[model samples]
Target chain A: MLVIDNLKASINGKQILKGISLHVKEGEVHAIMGPNGSGKSTLAAILAGREFAAIDGGSVSYFGRNLLDMAPEERSRDGLFLGFQYPIEIPGVSMVNFMKTAINEHRKYRGLEPLSASDFLKLMREKKELVEIDSTLTNRSVNEGFSGGEKKKNEIFQMAMLEPRLAILDETDSGLDIDALRIVANGVNKLKRKDSSVIVITHYQRLLDFIVPDVVHVLYDGRIVKTAGKELALELEEKGYDWIKKEAEKTEESWRVNPQ
Target chain B: MNGNICQGGLFTLQESTVSENMENDSDKILDEVTSGDYKYGFYTDIEADQIAKGLNEDVVRMISQRKGEPGWLLEFRLRAYRHWLTMKMPGWANLKIPEIDYQDIIYYSAPRQKVAPGSLDEIDPELKKTFDRLGIPLDEQKHLSGVAVDAVMDSVSVATTFRETLAEMGIIFSSFSEAVKEYPDLVKRYLGSVVPYTDNYFAALNSAVFSDGSFCYIPKGVRCPMELSTYFRINAANTGQFERTLLVADEESYVSYLEGCTAPMRDENQLHAAVVEIVSERGAEVKYATVQNWYPGDKNGRGGIYNFVTKRGICKGDNSKISWTQVETGSAITWKYPSCILKGDNSVGEFYSVAVTNNHQQADTGTKMIHIGRNTRSTIVSKGISAGVSQNSYRGLVKVLKKASGARNFSQCDSLLLGDKCGAHTFPYIEVDNQTAVIEHEATTSKIGEDQIFYCNQRGISTEDAIGLIVNGYAREVINKLPMEFAVEAQKLLQISLEGSVG
Candidate 1:
C-alpha cells in the first residue's frame, strides 16, 4: 500500500535521506534500525509533511496517490499517522475535546456526519480501556503535565482511536520504562489488523522484542547498509555498530578503487 | 469543532470580503500610520452640529442645551466643568501621553439623528443595519430579548435597546443622555459621587462634555436578567469619545455590564477620555467587563486612539463585592487603572486584566485598592503581553489605610515577551499604614520559547496553532475569569489579535 523510490531528502541544505527505496505491503511490519543520527527521525518527519524540507528528488506513493501533493491535515484524513517522539502539551484543550476534534475532522473529510456525544464518549471509553489510559488524564488538558510513559501511552491511545492505515512510531520506546513499554507494545498489537501496517523506527533493539517486525533494515550515515530478518536486530545488539562502520568503509574503498 | 455550536451557520461571503478589506486597509493604513499619526485624520463630508472644543461653562451649557437636558443636570455639568479647570493632568502615572489638544477636539457632535424612537419602528433602518452587521441581535421594530445595548456613534447615543424589559424588572438601563432626562433624580444623586469633577483631568473633562454613555441601576433584591452592553464607535474626525458609564447595584442585587469600543483609522491621534463608576451596596455583586479594541496607531506609531480612562468601583455597604475584568488589545496610548475603594467591612474587590501591546503601542494599566474597612480583601491579577517594539507597564498601588487593620490583599503580575525588542515593566507601590494588614505581590515575565513551538510542530500541529496555544495558556488565568459566553469569545479574539506574531 506504500511505495518510495530513490527517495532523496534534505533539511536546510543537508541531505539526510539519500537514495533510499522501500516497499511495504498491507498488514506487514517493517523495522528500520540505525545508529544515532541515521536519518530515522528524518524519515518520519518527511512522511508527516513537515515544512522547510527540500525534497531534492523523491516520488512517494500511498494508496496509489502522490503523498507529497497532499497537505498535512489531508494526509491525516487519509489515515496516515505519526507518533511523535515527544507529545505536545496543548493547555486548556482537553484530551477528550482534542480527540473529538480530530475524529470529527477526519469524518467530515470522509463526508460523514459527526458522532453523537454519547457515541463519542463511548468510543473514548473503549479506546481508553484498550490503551490503559487513566480516566483522570483524559479529562485534563491534552498531555499537559503527563509523565513520559503516560504521554507515550496517550499517543498509542490516539492511534487506536484514529485507526490509521499506516502508522509510523518515531522513538516511542525511548523514554518508556519496562512496564510502560510492555503496555504500549500490547496496545499496538491489539490494534494491528490484516490491512494496517506499522513502521517502527528505533535506535535500540528493546522495542523490537515487544513488537516483532517482519523485516528489519540497518541504516547508517543517512543510507540503508543492510536488510535482514528480526534476528538481525539481536545480532546488531550483541555485536554493536563498529563492524557495520568498518564494512561501510571497506565498501567505499573498493568503490573508489574500481571507479564505479 | 462542535457542529452544533455553529449558531451563525456558514461563514458569509460578505464576512470574507470584510475580512479581506480589513486586512488590506489595516496594512495600508499601518504603513502610513506607522509614524504615530492618525491616517483617518481627514473628515467625512457630513454636516454635523458640534459644540466647540475646550471645556468651560459655555461648552458645557451648549452640550446640555443641545441634549435638552434638565436644569439641574446642566447646572451639574457647569459645576463639574468649572471644577475641571482647577485640576491638572496627573503626572504620577507611568505613562508618556502626548500633550492633547483639548481645544482642537470637538467635544459634542450629533448626527442630526436625535429623534428619540418613541416606538422601535421609528428607528432608522441604516443605523439598525449597522448594529446587525456588528453581530448584535436586535428584534425587528422592537428591543432585543437577552441583551440591553446602548449604541453610541461619535459623541452621542443614537439608540438604546431593551429599555422596557429592563424597566419591568425595576432595573433602570438607559443611555446617559436619557437618564439625565428621564431619571434626573438618580442621575443627580450619584453623578460624580464616586469620581468627582476634580478627580483628574480626563475624568473632569468626561464629566463636563460627556455627550452620551450607558447608565444602569439594579433595584434592591433584584438580579439583572441579561447582560448590559454598550458599543461606542468614533466615526467623526477630531471628535473625542468621552463617554461616561455608571452602574449601581442595590442591596442584594447582582449585575454584569460589558462595554466595547472601536474607531476608524485616522491620521491625527484622537482623544478618548472616559470615566466609568460602579457602586455595590450591601450583599450586592457587580461585575464590569470591557473589551477595548480601539484603533492603535500604525507600526510606525502614527495615528491611534489615546485611551485615558478612569474606572472606579465603590464597595459602600458591608458584604458587598466588585470585580473588574478587562481585555485591552487596542489603543495607541493607554493610561487606565480601574480601581476599587473597599469601605465596608468584609467587602471584596478583584481586578483581572489581560493587556496586550504590539507594534509601537504603549499601555500603562493596572489597578489600585484602598482598603479601609475591617476584614476587607482585594485581589489583582494583571497579565501583560508585549510584542514588536511595543511597551507595556503595570503600575499598581495597594494601600492599607490606618484604620483598615484587618484588611488583606494579594496581587500577581505576569508579563510575556513575544520579541526581544519589546519591553514589559512592573512598578508596584505597596503602602502599609496599618500594621495588621496582610499584603502579598508576585511578578513574573516570560517569552514564547522556541522549544515549545518545536514540540508542537513535531506533533504535526502548525506553527500558528502552537503560538495560539501558548498564548491561550498564558491567558487562561485571566480568560477563565470571564463569564462562560465571553470566555469563548475572548479566546477567539486573542487568536485573531495576535496573528503573525508567532513566527
Candidate 2:
C-alpha cells in the first residue's frame, strides 16, 4: 500500500531522518519502535507531507503516486492520515464541524456530494460509537479543554470518521492511561480492513500488545537499524535500546572509515 | 504538522523555517485583502444640486432652508453651528487622524429634484440602479418582504417604501425632512432628546449641517411589523454625508431599526459624520443595528471616508431596554461610541460589536453603559480583528452611580491579530459608586497561530477558509445578537472583509 525509499530529511541544517527505506503491503501493520530523538515522528510527518522539514533526498510513493509532491491536505484527501502525537487544540472550532468539513473535503476530492445534515449526524453517531467518544466531547471545540486521554481518543475518532486506507499513528500510546490506551487501540483495530494498513509509531510495545503488528523495525540515529517481527518489539521492551545504540554507533564508525 | 509541534506536545514551539513560511503566507494574504477592490465604488451620473464648499452659519442655514425646515429648527441648526465653531476637535482616540479641512468639504449635496419623489416612478432610474447594484432595490416588489427601506443618496432620502402601509399601522416611518414637515412636534421633541448636539464635537457639527436621514416612531402598545432600514450612499464628490436618525418607541412598544452606509471610491477623503438617537419608554424595547462599509481608501491609504459618528440610546422609563449591534468593516479612520444611558429603574442596555480593520485603516470604537437608577443592568461584547498595517482598539466604559444600587454589568472584549504588522488593543474602564453594584470584565488578545492554520490545512481547508472559520467562531457571540437579516449580512461581510472572496 505504501513504499518509502531512502527518505532523507532535515530541519535548520540539522538532519533528522537519515536515509531510511520501508514498505508495507495491504492489510499489513508495521510497528516502528525507537527511543527519543530517533526521528520516528519525523518520518511519520514527512510521510504525511508536512513541509516543516526540508526533504534532502529520496522519495515516497503511495498507491503508485508521488506522495512527497502532494500537499498535506491533498495527502489527507487521498486517504493518507497522520494521527498526531500531540493533537492540536483549536478553540471555538467544534469537533462536529471540523470532522464534517474534513469528510466533505475528502468526498469532494473523490467526486462525491457532501453529506446531508442528517447523513452527517448519522455518520458522526456511528463513528462516535465505534471510537467510544461521547457526544459531549464531540460537541465541544476541537480538543479544547480536553484531557490528554480524550485528545488521543478524539484522534482515533477522527480516524474512524475519515476511514483512511493508511493511518500513521504517532505515539498514540503516549500520555494515555492503560484504559484509555486500550480504548484507542481498540478503535484502530476495529477500523482495520482487509484493504487498509497501519503504521504504529511508538516508543514502547505496550500499544502493539493491543493492536499487534505484523513486522517490527528499530529506528536508531535516524536510520532503521533493525527489522524483524512482533518478537523484536518484546525483545526491545525487555532489554531496552542500549544494545541497538551500540550497534548503531559501530555501524556509523564503519561508515566513516569506509566513506560510503 | 511536524515533529516541531511535538517538542513539548500540546502547545509547542514552531520551527523558525516553518514560521518563516507562515509569515510569508500571512503577509501574502494581508496584501491581498488590503489591496482588495472596493466592490461598491462605482459612481452614478445624475444632476445634483450642490452648495459651495465650506462650513459657516450661512451653509448651515442653507441646509435648513433647502430642507424647508421650520424657523425653530433653523435656530437650532444655527446655534449648533456656532457652538461647533467654538469647540476644538477631540483627540483622545488611538488613531493618527489627518487634519481635516472643513472649508474644503461641501456641506450639502443632494439630487436636484423639484420635490421628494411622489412615487417610485418619479425617482431617478440612475438612483434605482445604484441601490440595485448595492443589493438594496427601491422597488418594494423586488425587495425583502420583511424590510421597509429608506434609500438616502448623497444628502437626501430619495424614497421611503411601505410608508403608507406603515402609516396605517400608526408607525411614522419617513425621511427626516418629511418628518419635520409632517410630524413637526414629534421631530422637534425627540430629535436631540437622546443625543444632544452639545454632546461632542461631531454631534454638534452633524446637528448643524445634517441634510437628511430616516425617522421612525412606534406608537404606544404597537410592535413594528417590518424591519425599518436606511441605506445611506455617498454618491457626490467632495460632499460630507451628515445623516441624523431619530427613533422613539412609546410605552409598551417595540421596534428594530437597521442602518447601512456605503460610498463610491474617490481619490480624496470624504467626511461622514452621522448622529443616531433612539429612545424607549416604559416597558418598551428598541434594537438598533448598523453595518458600516464606507470606502476604506486605497492600498496606500490615500483616500477614504473619515467616519466620525455619534450613536446613543436612552431607556427613559422603567423596564425599558435598548440594544445596539454594529459590524464596522470600513472607513480609513473610524471613531464612534454607540452608548446607552440606563436612566430608569430596572432598565437594561446591551452592546454587541464586531469591528474589522485592514490595510492602513484605524478604528477605535466601543460603547458606554451608564447606570443611573436602581437595579439597572448592561452587557457589552466586542470583537476586534486587525490585519495588514491597521490598528483596531476597543475602548469602553461602564459607570454605576450611587443611586444605581444592585446594578449588574458584564463586559467582554476580545481582539484577534492576523499578522505581525497589525495591532489590537482593549481599553475598558469601570466605575462603581454603589456598594451593591457588581461588575465583571474579561479581555483577551490572541494572534492567529501557525499551528492552528496548519491543522486546518491538514484537514483539506485552505488557510483563508481556516481564518474565516476561526474569526467567525470568535465573533459568533456578537454576530448572533444582530437581527436575522443583518446577521447574515454581517457574517458575509466578515468573510469578505478580512478573508477576501477566496474560498
Candidate 3:
C-alpha cells in the first residue's frame, strides 16, 4: 500500500532523514521507533505533504502513484491521514463547523452530495461514542483551551471520522494518561480494517501493548537499523536504546576507517 | 546558508526552491481572488432633471427652488451653506484624502418622474430592471415581504410602501421632501437637532445641498409593525450624493430602521456626504442597521466613492435605548463615526460595526459613546478586516461626564490582516470624569498563519473556503448583532470581499 525509497530530507540544510526506506502492505501495522531526534516526525510530515523540509532525495509511491506530485488536500481526499503530535489550536472555529466542513469536502471529492445537518449530527454522535469524547469537547472551538489528554483523544476521534486508508500516528500516546491511552488505542483498533494500514511512530512501548504492531523497526540517526517481530518492543522496553546506539556508532567508526 | 558566491558549484542541485514555490502559489491565489471583478458595476439609462455642476449660493437656491421648499427650509440651507464656506475640510483622520474640487461636482440630480408619484407605473422600467438585477425585491408580494422600503434612486425617494398600515398606527413613514411638505413642524423640530448643520465639514455640505432621504416617526406608546428601510443608489455620474435620514421614536415607542446603499462604477471619484439623526424619547427604543456596499472602484483604485458622513443619536428622555449596527464593505475611502449621546438617566446605547477594505480601499471608522446622564450605560464592538493592499483602522471614543455618576461602558476592538501588504490599526479614546464610572476596553490584532490554512487544506477544504470560515469566525461577535436578513448578506459580502486576498 505504501513505499518510501531512500527518503533523504533536510531542514535548513541540516540533514534529518538520511537514506530512510520502509514498506507496508494492506492490513499490517508497522512501528517506527527511535530516540528523541531520530527523524520520526519528519517522516510523518513528509508523508503528509508538509513543506517545511527540503526533500534532498526521495521517491514515495502510494497505491502505485507518485505521492510527491499531489497537493496536501489531494493527499487527504485520497485517504491519507496524519495525526499531528502537536495539534494546532484554531480560535473561533468550532469543532462542529470544522468537522462538518472537512467531511463534506471529502464527500465532494468522492463525487457525493454533502450530508444533511441531521445526518451529520448523527454521525458526530456515533463517532463521539467510539472515541469517548463527550458533547462539551466538540461544542467549543477546535482544540482551543483543551487539556493534553483531550487533544490526543480528539485526534483519534478525527481519525475515526476520516476512516483513511493509511494513517500515520506520530507520538499520539505522549501526552495521554493511562485511561486516555487505552481509549485512543481502542479507537484505533476499532477503526482498522482489512484494507487499511497503520503506522505508529512513538518513543515508548506502552502504546504498542494496546494496538500491537505486526512488524517493528529500530531507527537510529536516519536509517532503519533493525526490523523484527513485535517482541522487539518488549525487549527494547526492558533494556534501553544504549546497545543499539553503541553498535551503530561502531559501524560508523569502522566505515570511516575502511571507506566502505 | 549564506551564498556570497557559488564559485565551486557546491550547492547547485535543485532547480527551484520548494518553499518559495509554495508561498508563491498561495500568494498568486490570494491575488486572483481579491482582484475578482466587481459584480454590481453596471449602469442604467433614464431621463433625469440634473442641475449644473458647481456649488454656490445659486446652486443651493436652485435645489430649494426645484424642490419648492418653504422659506424656512431655504433659509436653513442658506445658513448651512454660509457656515460651510467658513469651514475647511478636516484632516485629522488617518487618511490620505485627495483634494476634492467641490465645484467640479454636480450638486443635484434626480430621475424625472413624468407621471403621478403614488403608482409603481411612475418608476421607469429600465430602473426597475436594474433593481431586479440588484436582487432588490421591491415587489412587496415577492421580496422583503414584511419590510417596507422607501426606494431612493439618485437622491429622490421614488417608491414608498407600507405607509397606510403605519398611518393607521399613528406612525409617519415617508420621503424627506414629503415630510417637509406634510409635517414641516416635526421636520423642523427634529432635523439637525441631534446632528446640527454646523457639525462637521461633510455635515455642513450635506445640509446645504442634501436632496432627499428617508424620514420616519413613531408616535407615543406605539410600536412600528414593520421594518423601515431605504435603499440609496447613486445613479447619475459625477453627482455628489447628499443623503439625510431623520428618525424619531416618541415616548414609549419602539422602531427598527435600516439604511443600505450601492453605486454604479464611474471613472471619476464620487463624493458621498450624508447625515443621520435619531432622537429617542422617554422609555422609547430605536434600532438602526446599515449595510453600505457602494462601488469600491477597480482593483487599481482608479474610481470609487469618497464616503464621509455624520451619524448621531440622542437619548433625550429617561430610560430610552438606542443601538446602531453597520456593515461597511465598500468605497475607495471611508471616514465616518456613528455616535450616541446618552443624555437620559439610566439610558443605554450600543454600537456594532464590521468594516472590510479590499484592493486599494481605505476605511477609518468607529463610534463614539458620550455618557451625560447619571447611571447611563454603553457598549461598543468594532471589527476591522483588511485584504489586498488596503488599510483599515478603528477609531473610537468613550466619554463620561462629571455629572454622569455611576455611568458604565465596555468597548472591544479587533483587527484582522489577510496579506503582507494590508494594514490594520486601532485608535481608542477613553475619558472618565466621575470616580464612580466603570469602564473596560479590550483590543487584539491577529494574522492568519499558513499553518491554519494548511490544516484546513489537509481536511479537504479549499483555501478560499477556509479563509471564509476563519474570517467569519473572527467577526462572529459583531455579525451576530446585525438583523437576520442583513446578517446573511453581510456574511456573504465579507467572504466575497476577501476571496483571494490573503496568503
Q: Write the per-residue lDDT of candidate 3 for residues B189-305, one digit (tens) a residue.
A: 998999998999899999999999999999999988888898888899989889899999999999988888889888789999999999999999999999898999888988999
Over the full model, what C-alpha lDDT does candidate 3 score relative to the true structure? 0.86
> Could you give candidate 1's per-residue lDDT for residues B210-315 as a string of tens digits?
8889899999999999988898878778888889988999999999888877777777899999999998999899998888888887667888899999999999
**Each model's lDDT:** 0.80, 0.88, 0.86
Order the candidate numbers by DockQ, best to worst.
Answer: 2, 3, 1
Residue B219 CA error for candidate 3 (Å)?
1.9
Instruction: Output the worst ten-in-a-row residue range by lDDT, candidate 2 chain A.
Output: A45-54
**Taking the tens digit of each residue's C-alpha lDDT, what string does model 2 give over B244-346?**
9999999999998888989988999999999999999999999898899999997788899999999999999999999999999989999999999999899
Compare the candidates by lDDT and give the number of the best one: 2
Tell me the spans in candidate 2 whose CA falls farther than 4 Å from its real position. Answer: B1-21, B29-35, B113-115
Clashing residue pairs in candidate 2 are none
Off by over 4 Å in 3: A257-260, B1-26, B500-503
DockQ of each: 0.26, 0.47, 0.38
